[model samples]
Target chain A: MAKIQIIVICTNLIFLAFIARLIIKAKLREEYAIVWLLITVLLALFSFWRKGLDVVSKLFGVYEPANFVFTGFIFFILIYLLHLSIVNSKLQKSITKLTQELALLKEQLKETNKSKIN
Target chain B: MATQLLIIIPCFNEEDSIVSLLNELNQMVVPNTFIITVAVINDCSNDNTSVIAEKFSVVVINLPVNLGIGGAMQTGYKYAWENNFDVAVQMDGDGQHPPAELNKLLQCWHNTQANVVIGSRFLVNQGFQSSLLRRWGISYFHWLNKFFTGIHIYDSTSGFRLFDRKAIELAVQYYPDEYPEPESIVFFAKSGLSIHETPVIMKERQGGKSSIRHFYQLYYIIKVSIAMFFSFIRK
Candidate 1:
């Protein structure tokens, strides 16, 4: 294997090991850890099979394999960002609902206390 | 059945204008209404807005953190939905939306039985016309909305609006986090909800700067246009 390919594979393996540690330590949820593990594995696979990216790029009519890799990385990042935004939006909605309910419940409790005292 | 109306005024540091606006609302009576309650969603205002709002008969929902106008308004809608309010009206707390014109919206709601009734300034060209740049921005969105949804809402950016039970229910579930007014019109129309626009005069804001400044006008236009485009494509 080429020195650069070996380096890439080693980096990917290190990242995979780090993610596994996080998963084992319960720092990252299993669902997200699975996604990270899959990405790392794919990176290691591509690094081991250096010609695989060129083959896929050629099949997809991409002239430059490096450009294809960058584009794919960017596309994945955008999808992940979009997913995070959706989750953030859902959490925002639920938080707003909870705050409203808490405010109303506080008001009700105040009214009840006042009536009881009267 | 007599309509139970909840007027939701989303205020953020409007210390100068809120008191007088609340007083104006206090005196004005909407005819043919069963119960009228004014509530203020104090969006974590740094000023004494909450104290002033509480001085009146208004119910104040003091948010622990700032949620901007859209989130604050959604809280009010959720309150209306849970409290069994037949209708909810969104009026700005900056004293721009005239309380006297509220009856016109209620009347439109009664007559058309529409899911949402919007108070439009461009319909009759009455009251405080916005700046030239702002008006141009509004016209762009107006045209974009027509092109996208085939619906003509002259003032899609107007916050003065009346929402019926169905509309309130929908908004309570989900509302755009920011710049929601224009996007909401397109959303409601696409969702098969009936929307009616009534001509009403609006005054210039009494105090505090507008969230969208002159420098941000271009950015606002681009952001809202992109947001509308996404809403159009999204299922």
Candidate 2:
């Protein structure tokens, strides 16, 4: 019982640290942080429930400290992918804006040149 | 003397300016402008740019894939080399570059008989209300050019210029794909080509937002700087 309690507190503390770091980094959006926070919390709970995780980890041949570390890596990668998606969206928007502005300018330039011709 | 100049106007999605740019080019008082071919490299524009360009007597190079500014230029340079012209001028198809002032660079080319005559907006510390970042980039590369290749080119990144056959040969033979504009100056100087500049008036790009993205702006500066440094070290 004491071992379980200690593991639970340690996992919660580590997960809480991740949440604090993400907030400070301010890269991932709030909505993304919510989903990530939920996942971390769930994983923390799962790690606290040792017997279930032990069985799952044994099944995956990650029965040692591997479960917590692997879960942490996956959670970080998910957050990173979310950040990247947002960046890609911004690039797309800028490219669209530029192309549209170019089209409009070409029209005005055409009119200017035409008037000068007469 | 119009000097039978072959002006290479590189266009991507410039359907908007193609016709009028052609009109302006036709009216220019350049002597014997024989084949003033505006090589429009259709960067796979989904628009009607190619159809519009075809209406004019301009040479159109349709790339199966978009190779960007450098690729478009190489295609045009290849066309210029194949056709056999005395001089080739690179004017922007975006309507930013004035067609009339092409004469200034051409004149510089003829007068100085330099291998490469650039239409420089930065030569006299004039032209373009550039961003602070861009200004810094220009200054850094100008210094790098002097430091690396012992060639001092003022406007290291201007796409507007005239290149004779000798300059074209080197560029066509070996030009970097990603950031070719700045790096090309280094290559031109390294090849012992007399690089000269002419003061020409330029304006804000009238249409389409510039292709340089905010995030990639630093990437561009870094990539070119590395290439310049590495190319220097290679020497």
Candidate 3:
């Protein structure tokens, strides 16, 4: 019923719709979109249940509900960033392997062509 | 029995010294039983490095994209593996690693049968000992590497190294992408490969700038330190 709760509810609703549009347009893959959707839905659930955040924070032994929300979101972001770095490292290894293989194959092809001429 | 020795020269933009280095290598004498083959991995140099190397009778692999020294060296190792080379020696294209002293590495390998042989400038306490600041950095890595792997490498950053078939296979499987020298020593030691160090004189680079610059000293130290740690813990 409070103005802040209504604002939070409206913001999360808009975010959910935006994510749905992205998924529908094939702009976001399902694996990644799942995380975003989970975040938005969690925020929406807390906004709809007025005492939800306060109860959760108290259960987690945090003195302030707002501090808990900030810390929780930051923790999520850090985890996601770590996942991204792992993926990036794998991609880099693959690219290096591919480049090496391509160069080797090209050299082999040249040798084959040279021998054919002789 | 003939030993297939493949010398891997990973070059960047070393047009000034590539020709002379190749000539020196060609002129170097090895034992009768060893058949030496030189393979230069040009790391997408903008200069005429690949062009000049192509004129020689060596294998020249030109990577389309610049994949730093680690990637370039890995390419050479991959080639060595595929071609069934018995031993692979890595030397700089800048002519710092003297071809005349290659016997020291071969002799060490012959006597000790080490899986990997490193040519250390600091072993004899002589010859082109880098600047005071660089020496300090090398010493730091020496101690750090010793602490982690329980193996002491006097010149851990030396590019002059020889890898036998087992070492070459390991290199092809996984190699550090950037700043790999010191970190790789630790990795090889941890992987149960026997490593031996021999004294070899290194000359000041004939041409081309050193890869490690003054501005990037801190970054290099931090990156290598982190890489060493990760390599230690890697399964």
Candidate 4:
């Protein structure tokens, strides 16, 4: 029981700190803050809810809540990391596409400028 | 004044709007004193996007395979970097980014000496029209960018922008395919480049539906937030 209470308090404090940091120091995008807030809340909920873990384990035919929660946390983190990797890949590619087009346009302009000067 | 400005337009199966966009660009009448180049990155487009771009005298780069926007743009950058250009602008092929207004961005960077100058529709009440849901998404992105990058971003996800030689060099080497705008901001910031925004009027696209993947925006927000939070401290 005490462990659950400590987890809950820690989670709330972490959330408070995050919010305060964003408001006071971080000039980050609001959309990004929403995403972080959601994730933090989700993590907090997962950390504290013993019944939720037990139910998830029972539903999945697992016997131990600790194992179930631990496994679930690891799985979720892995998926999220993969998701970030995919986004990073896509962002990089888009920049490349636009950079290429811009370079070509500038080249044509250069030729035109040279021709006119001559 | 003695710099070459290249504009890369990434199109994915854009047939209907490609022609109009090309015409607009050609009609813009860039000052003869300012050298300009326009390259269309066709990401293995299944449609006539390549044919249309080529016909307009714009250099068309057809990617051997679909690399999405990031992949297509990377191909463009590699070409630009290899060829040695002074500046690069990223323009969407969806007929939304006004080619005529591109000079505004160039001028902002030229005058202020900023490393990056992005066309910001939010700066002007141009009555930018989009689905309410999309508007919400854009707002969400704007917020997300501020949280992660520690920069007050006027346009968090806009692709219409100009980059200096330094930015182009960095982008070609490290940019990712998805979430290009937010992720690149972090890259530029981490590398200690000054980023700027210029207000521009963007017209609603006339054709070729946006191919944004389902749930990509949400997923991107979470991923980028974490990445930037960590990358900010580490790099």
Q: Please report, in order, the local distance difference test score of every candidate based on alpha carbons.
A: 0.90, 0.73, 0.94, 0.76
Sort the candidates on DockQ, descending order. Answer: 3, 1, 4, 2
Order of candidates by lDDT, top first? 3, 1, 4, 2
lDDT by residue for model 3 (A8-36), tens: 99999899999999999999989999999
TM-score: which is higher, 1 or 4? 1
The segments of candidate 2 whose C-alpha lies over 4 angstroms from its true place after superposition are A1-118, B1-3, B33-35, B125-127
Q: Among all windows of ten consecutive residues in candidate 4 chain B, which has the lowest summed lDDT?
A: B226-235
Answer with 1 or 4, whichever has the higher lDDT: 1
Better structure of 2 and 4 per TM-score: 4
Question: Can you give the lDDT of residue A48 in candidate 3?
Answer: 84
User: Which pairs clash in the backbone of model 1?
Assistant: none
Q: Per-residue lDDT for A1-118 in model 4, tens only?
A: 6776687768777786877687667675675577677767766776677478778789999999889878977997798789789988678656555555564565557568868999
DockQ of every candidate structure: 0.36, 0.03, 0.73, 0.07
DockQ of 2: 0.03
How well docked is model 3, in DockQ terms? 0.73
Stretches of candidate 1 exceeding 4 Å from the true structure: A1-21, A38-79, B230-235
lDDT of 4 by residue, B1-235 (tens): 5678788888898898888888888788765766777888887789888777777777777765566776677667776787788888899888789888888897788789988898888888684656767677777767766776767776767888888888888877777665567677877877989899889888887787766656875676677667656656765
Model 3 stretches with alpha carbons more than 4 Å out: A1-14, A21-27, A47-51, B233-235
True contacts kept of each: 0.30, 0.00, 0.78, 0.09
Worst lDDT window (10 residues) for model 1 chain A? A102-111
Candidate 4 Cα deviation (angstroms), residue B62: 0.9
Q: State in Å the error of residue B233, model 1.
A: 5.2
lDDT string, candidate 1, A1-118, tens digits: 7999988988988898899899889999998888898898888889888899999999989999999999999999999999989988888877866776777677667668978999
**Top candidate when judged by lDDT against the true structure:** 3
